[model samples]
Target: MNILITGASRGLGLALADESLKRGHSVIAAVRSPEHGGKLAELRERYGANVETAMFDVTDETAIARFAAGYAARGKRLEAIINNAAILTERGSSIEELDMTEVARTFDVNVLGPMRVVKHLLPLMDGTGGVIVNISSEAGSLHGAYGGDYAYGTSKTALNMFTEQLKHAVKPRGIAVYAVHPGWMKTDMGGSEAPGDPRTSASGILDLIERRTAPSRRFSFVDYSGSAMDI
Candidate 1:
């Protein structure tokens, strides 16, 4: 599979990149900064031609368009895109006290970022039967509980809606879209006190994708265990 993972430098995205490489897939490791993307250079050395790195900013539509053109020129098409780039505002004083700047920053990455990614990449993925997995959260579940993390939850909710819209628009062309809850992962963003390790979450999510044959109308909301969630 020719996989493109945004925010591949760390956390669950990095873990997913590692696991996919181990499975002998051609991977395009996408990161905001080449200098900051970790372990990817080493993996490129180990995996030889199987792994390649791409410097991309998710918030920039121009960069994504250029990336799509460049990759197509290389005679490759993206089989999957893991939309994992995001930010959180968990430690703010309170929902009312949260800084508005922080809210804008969160939406830039968590909401609009994925939409921009799809805008450029979806056309290339048209005939290739691609998949788009948005890294979503349980906190976005309005049926579950409203959380203290207002900004993060709101952005994820928007992401979920976008995923739904994309699935509807693309399913006829054999494209699949899903919203994944990586499950309170113990990454820098998930915090040290988080429950699951990054590796576990990545493995489970990969398994779920491999096992699913059809896209769901409800947008395929699932945890790391393949358990469905109300959207």
Candidate 2:
């Protein structure tokens, strides 16, 4: 399958790309920077043209649109898009004392970015029977024990609603939209305290994407193990 991943330069997204390549899938790794996307470049070299890349920052809408048009011109149709780019602003601060600027930045990266990505990519996915997996957080669950997430949780909750709306709009267009909680994996985002690793998380997510059978309106809460949660 031909796949596009937005945050393939590091952590969970990179792990997903590595495993997919090992399974012999065509991958298009989109990074915010071409020169700075070192891991993706390394994969491109190791995979020998099986992996390709486009410079893309999910927050930048126009650039992604232009890139999409170019890929379409080249006859590149993606089977899936992993909207994995995100940021966590309340890494160390209490919600009340947190800097407002940091909160805005988190929304910019996590919430607005995915919205921009879907606005452009969903149209391309029309009639193509593609899959959209938003890398959302279980912290986004309103029914859960909400603690210190602050901007991250709020942004992800917004993303969850966005995923639900997206699913409704695209299901008829032969597209599948699902928000997946990838577990507290050890990554820059998940930090050293995380119990799960990106490799494990990536494997589970890939399996779910591959094995998903029927379509439904699922504003689902799913862990890396593909276990459904009480949303």
Candidate 3:
């Protein structure tokens, strides 16, 4: 299967690419900076033709548009798209200390970015039925909403909504959309104390996708382990 993954420069995204390649699947690794894509470069060197690097920022609509056009020109067909590009700003700010500007930027990347990617690239999935994974967070869940995560939390909530709506919109095409909360991993975002290994998370997620075992419901909010998350 041909898979496209945004934010493939590092962390969980990189792990996903690695795991996919190990499974002998072709990967289109999308990263914001090709200069900083050394790890991806290594993967390409090792995996050869199975790995292709694409440079584009999810926040740039024009860049995504251009990439989409070029991708279509190449007649590429994708079996999956993993919307993994995102930012975490105002991490622990309270309502009183919230920065509205940071909040807007968070929404732009975490929410609108995936929307733009889907809008432009959905055509590539045209006759090829597949899945779309939106990397969301448990912070987005209203089930146990807490304080101190105003920006990132809200952005993920909106992303979850987008995932739900997108599932319905693409149902006719036999495409499945899922909002996944990758467990806290020791990445730049999850910090040093995080316990979850990104490789484990990537393996489980790919397993879920490859096996087509996600819940057959209107919407699915799941953890990397394939357990249902409260929506």
> Which numbered prediction scores highest in lDDT against the true structure?
3
Candidate 1, pairs of clashing residues: none
Question: Please, what are the lDDT tens digits per residue for candidate 3 over residues 1-231?
Answer: 999999998999999999999999999998887685788878988999999988899999899999989989988888899999899999888788888999999999999999999999899998988989999999999996888899998889999999989988998999988899999999999999999999999998787668546665555788887778887
State which candidate, 2 or 3, has the greater lDDT. 3
Clashing pairs in 3: none
TM-score of each: 0.93, 0.92, 0.97
lDDT of each: 0.82, 0.81, 0.89
lDDT per residue for candidate 1 within 116-194, as digits (tens), equals 9889887777688877889899988888856477889888888888888888999798877889888887888878898
RMSD of each: 1.8, 1.9, 1.1
- lDDT, candidate 2, equals 0.81
Q: Candidate 2: where is the Cα deviation over 4 Å?
A: 212-217
Native-structure RMSD, model 1: 1.8
lDDT of 3 at 116: 94
Worst 10 residues of 1 by lDDT: 208-217
Rank the candidate models, highest TM-score first. Answer: 3, 1, 2
TM-score of 1: 0.93
Candidate 2 worst ten-residue window by lDDT: 212-221
- Which candidate tops TM-score? 3
